[model samples]
Target: MLHVRAVCPAEHTAEVVELLREHPGAAHLVLHRGAAVSPEGDLVEADVAREAADEIVDGLCGLGLDRTGGITLEALDTAVSDAADAAEEAAPGEAADAVVWQELLGRTGEESRVNATFLGFLAIACLLAAVGVLTDSPVTVVGAMVVGPEFGPLAAIAVGLVLHRGDLVRRAGLALLVGFPVAMAVTLAGVLAGSAAGIFDPGTIDGNHDVDFVYQVGPASFVVALLAGAAGMLAMTSAKSAALVGVFISVTTVPAAGYVVVAAVAGRWDRAGFSLLQLVVNLAGIVLAAAIVLIVRWRRQRSAPLLRPLSRG
Candidate 1:
């Protein structure tokens, strides 16, 4: 369930109430008339079932409430009300299956921005992976993957493509286009420094170990990337984020990019080429899988509002 807080203009308060009254999924509805000071208006609140949130938000937007005032949704850690249980039961679909598009777009918009923090995390993750590649340490590579922030924008790109939002697609593209190259450059410098200090042995990397997986662009890589992408999409949409760490470790994106850097710095052109191939394959698989997941999740539901019509006296 989601707790929705809305500030509706005076003119739209009645419409807002009528709309909520029509939705069985809206429970514990509260209205405070003329209570808001900033952009002064009425304050309306409700606990809405996840299955019905998309429709309720759509109705509110259709009434122009978003422009006039604003609405915000917060997930409940626990809702112990009988009313909440009843609302969920009355909603047409299972809560777990629902996809709140507005919420997702809003989330991806914030994450897709190309900023210093985003780049910093990417650079650090890549540098860590460079160390992992040169030393042939699977543990270090997994750590880099966990620290990498690339998946957020990657998921944003998929969301943009699914929703046909050009701006989001461009934003996500910019982040990726700039971030990966910058991370690779930093990793290259790090590898050079490590080599000069005798911390990284190129011979270790040249041999077969867990690090070899970072450059092996085979059928297994593609299959794992697809599975990771779908799992990532599910983690992003659901309330629980524990699945995200598993998603992170399951893909070879950061490690592959890191291998490209280390191999290029070591003047191993063949290894660099294969590492780049691995990077491309993983990214392509992830994006395609995420886009497919979003399409199927959003397009499946077709039904009337979960709220039954009010009786005509």
Candidate 2:
């Protein structure tokens, strides 16, 4: 479905070919050798499917093929030649790559950290959701969901658990701990400002306004969170990143956090507690669901047969 292009030194062509031949999911491998003109001159050009690109890159790196030479892999937009698949089949190699367990663990850990960008987006999302809460507009609430960036850390936590990465667990936990409070505080401040300006009245809390949607968190919300989390994790690991935007908008964390701010400003402690509960329920459901999905994937990967090098015919 995806295409991959790689360039390596000509002298390392044999190793590259052998690596691709062993990868089971990889097909349509094309190799053009002695065409590059770098400072060293004449490298090998390889084109492959996007599905197998990650495995191939990891394999070549493991074989020390990149130490002296160079390897670059990129996704292609168009279909490749069928002849490339035939050549890969005829090649003499196994169908597997060396697993870099430590590197995988490290990458998983890095993905879970709540970096600056995530915090910034969370701030904006919460502020937007605060406006939605004040106005009781479902449309604006949905917009806040679309803009929130909380899914990355949650997915990172799931991957971390599957890989048993302590660092990832810590980082994800820290993000959740810090992110919610900061967002809530900002929303509270916004609510206070709106109230002071007479744009929003604290008395609106009791008015059974059509926007009472903020107070009705239940099992359906949990289900939505679970589905979004699963989709989010898949998007993170797979090549399709656009799907993540949908997942972000499908959950209610931002809206619930914003509701808490509104309630705090209105001096309605009970409503604030209810909104906080909704936030907790949503987050718990998402994290648990993502963890389950990752665990299943890890198990499947472990049970797969290891490929052996092909015997010379």
Candidate 3:
């Protein structure tokens, strides 16, 4: 379930209250008229089923409340009300299968932002992957994959494309476009520093190591990326985010970028090119698969009659 708190304009307060009161998936409605000073409106709160979150939020957005007012949703760990249980039971779809478009937009919006934290995580993850490749350590490589924060923007780009939100697409694109180069540059610096310190030789990247999969670009790579992308979108939309770890480890996006840097630094143009291609291939596969799945799911949700919540006149 979700707890919704909204500040609505004076003229829209009654309508908002009626919307919640009539919605089968909403209960425990509270309206505090003229309670807000900053926004200068009424404060309305309600408990709503997770399955109906997408619909409820969409309606609010359609009413222009998101722009003229404010709407926030918080997950309820435990709602010990019979009304809450009834709301969930009355909603059409299962909560586990709900898409919650607003949730996706909000989450990916933040994740896709190009910030120091995002770049730092990517750089550190790629550097770890560089070390993993140099040592031919599969465990280290997997750890790097898990540490990489690139998946958020990737999923954001997919959702943006599916929803035709140019802002989201641009933000996600900026994050990826800038993030990779930044991470690679950091990896290059790390490589140079380690070399100057005599920590490891650049030639460690030359031979056929156990981590060949990082630069081996093949059909299997694309297949795995495709599957991972679908699973990733499924997890995001349905809120089964525990599956994200598997999605991270299954794709080689970060490792390939790290290998590209190590190969280039070692004067191995052939290997560098292969690794670059691998990175592109995996990225393309994941985004393409995720976009396709999101489109289909959105269409299904749009076509379902249950998406229309019962609102009072």
Whose lDDT is greatest here? 3
Candidate 2 lDDT by residue in tens digits, 1-313: 3344445566666877777666654666666656655625244445544434445555766655445555554445554567556544543332232222333344455555677777778888888887877776778888898888777677767766666655677888899788878877877787788889988876676763655666567888889889988887666555456888888878888888888888877788888888888888888888888888766655555643332221111
Query: Candidate 1, overall lDDT?
Result: 0.86
Compute the lDDT of residue 9 as modeled in candidate 3: 98
lDDT of 3 by residue, 212-240 (tens): 88989999999999999999999998888
lDDT of 2 at 67: 56
Worst lDDT run of 10 residues, candidate 2, spans 304-313
Q: Residues 1-313, candidate 1, lDDT per residue (tens digit)?
A: 9988889899999999989887999999999998988879999999999988889987887777777788888888799999999999998878877887778888888888899999999999999898888777899999999999988888999998887777888998899999999999888888888788987766567684778888878999999999999999988876557999999999999898998888887788898999999988999999999998987876674352322211111
The top-ranked prediction according to TM-score is 3
What's model 1's lDDT at 143?
Answer: 99
Q: What is candidate 3's local distance difference test score?
A: 0.89
lDDT of each: 0.86, 0.66, 0.89
| Model 1: lowest-lDDT 10 consecutive positions | 304-313
For residue 4, model 1's alpha carbon misses the true position, in angstroms, by: 0.6
Please say which candidate is ahead in lDDT: 1 or 3.
3
